[model samples]
Target: MKKLILLLLVFPFFVIAQDLPTVYPFISEGAKYIDREASIALEINILERDISTGNIDSNLLDFGLEVFEYYNKYGAISEDVYFEYLEQSEYGDSWLSCIVPDYVSSTLKSQGNNSYNKSNLGDRDPRTAWVEGADGYGIGEYIEMRVYAEALKDLRILNGYQKSIKSWKDNSRVKSFKVYINNVPVRILELEDRMGEQIISFDDLLPEGFDIWSAEDFEIKLEILAVYPGERWKDVCISGISFFGCYC
Candidate 1:
């Protein structure tokens, strides 16, 4: 009985190991990317086309791509990008501006987190809506990731500019915002939602190496939860993404 139980317990491990593929070792450098600009957003495309196994695991289609800022020679800053919140219109229509064409198709639905399970990390539960929506009745779902740049300057954010975010006024919830310089935590400015076009003030000051007189650090990362409430999930569509900064 003891040996039988042991075999049963180890059997699943073998099964899982068999289920996982070793052919496509994770290519970390190629998988990771950086965009140095005033405002930059990234999109990651995940698919289950394992050339080794003719089978595809649609459930493993979701993954997180982290962003970071480097400072000096030994410091780094990073954060997990999260879904922001959205509100319905006063007339009960889903706020359309918050909806982008890139994520507006029935082919896919947003997966909540890295697990690719139905659970959402933040308030909004992104959809795992059927790949075919309700039309096909029982087909699976697909999803894509999208990020948007919120500014038109040098990708720099000032503490004073966050004052326009509407969520700041509500003391009831913890607004998600973070920043770092050379791995050191920096203060993030909270603002009202209406301050969308506001720019951070540096007074012509850049980081130490940038200009001898510059006081603010030039290489820094500011992270904020961009989507929330309605859902962290995004529908997929084909179109060019628009941002407020120059693209390389």
Candidate 2:
């Protein structure tokens, strides 16, 4: 009997120890939830006093609550508040929060300048492809890429292949490239014109109803394609890239 009881206690500890690290704790607590069909509403508000002056006190803004509504097993309705956090604002005369439309719209366009390029490749260099680099190499460099305040923004390639080439025999052409945004893969432009600069604008390709990122933190990734031989990817050059927008 003692052994059985001990096994139960030890088992629980082992399970918790293994699962604890993977489970992200909630900043604020309420009812537990699953991603069932439900509605999530986020809001932000600014006090009139804070906007009266041209300068805004970041301390005076309210971030608001994250709410979720769903139905219980018995068909009963339920609503809960999940987490609490303070929203940040720009230094301006008017106060603003994430809930406002203007704050969300600002992220729609390219904001500032940030660039990424593949280093020059020598005649017979193996590191000519788009693998993560050391000294802040390409892949797995950061868990998340973001732009906040007066800092460099992360730039992502639109796709792996911008165009198709028939000169090479079959699959000899560079098929894809990789870029990371906020530690996640978001865009991938296929093979295109390799000689001249090709521009990619993300606003045109973003998913419908996907609101512009209002928070200071966001994640995205990009992939570019490279071919071998005369058109070896090593010969290509990515001058630079950038991002711009107000993060609410």
Candidate 3:
């Protein structure tokens, strides 16, 4: 019986290991040192094709790309890019804007005199919020939105209740969020306890060969993994969420 149980546990791990691609073995020492960009690009194309044909798992590809990106010291999208786009938008640059999602929904919503529905997340108002109705700190709750993926580059979130300083302090805030793109776990966004907008760039996280300009619309879900407890309230709140992208 002991041996049978051990085999059962080890069998699953063996299957998982088989499912993951051997991405590193494909890169030669010469390719890594001689023409890294060209080599990586070629491998990415081949991997993408295999993924599309169901020959390789998408998650495995993501893991492989992340390893390469880390070794290459590729950085996430910078605030400067966001600021530059903002400046251009002021001068009739209609190509880019804060995208309001086509649909927004939450697992639970707190009932109150004022509305605390999912719609509040995209209203662009820090004063209003989507509060989780769950008991305690509302861990494990989630909010999801669907938006056009074309040129989608960044995600902006205003964490916690922001009606007033008092309100912000009275309600709980998200400390970490597990972000999922189209139901595949992508990144975990760790937020500061302080009040302000937090930006998350997709530049480093998106799967290789995913053309944001041509892909169909996709869903993004943010699951609350942890929270900064409030002094007075058990409910957790998020003031707003906005997507930065170019329509063209």
Best candidate according to TM-score: 3
Q: Which of the two candidates, 1 or 3, achieves a greater TM-score against the reference?
A: 3
Between prediction 2 and prediction 3, which has the larger TM-score? 3
Better of 1 and 3 by lDDT: 3
Kindly list the per-residue Cα lDDT of model 3 for residues 1-248, writing each as its tens digit.
Answer: 99999999999876653343211111112211123234334555564455445675444444344332332353332333323323332322123343444444442544566788777776545577888887789888887777677767777777788776677788999988766678766566677775566666667545556676777887877778899999899889887777666444
Q: 82-132 in candidate 1: lDDT tens per residue?
A: 222112211221111222322222432444642222122111222211222
Per-residue lDDT, model 2, residue 58, is 46
Write one digit per residue (lDDT tens) for candidate 2, span 1-248: 99999999899766643332111111121322211112212121122222334244444344322211111122322222221222232334332222111111011112154112232111111111112223211222221233342322222221121222222211122233433344333333343323222333345333334454544544443333233333443222222223433333
A best-first ranking of the candidates according to their TM-score comes to: 3, 2, 1
Question: TM-scores, in order shown?
Answer: 0.21, 0.28, 0.59
Q: What's the ranking of the predictions by lDDT, best on top?
A: 3, 2, 1
Where does candidate 3 have its weakest 10-residue lDDT segment?
A: 23-32
Best by lDDT: 3
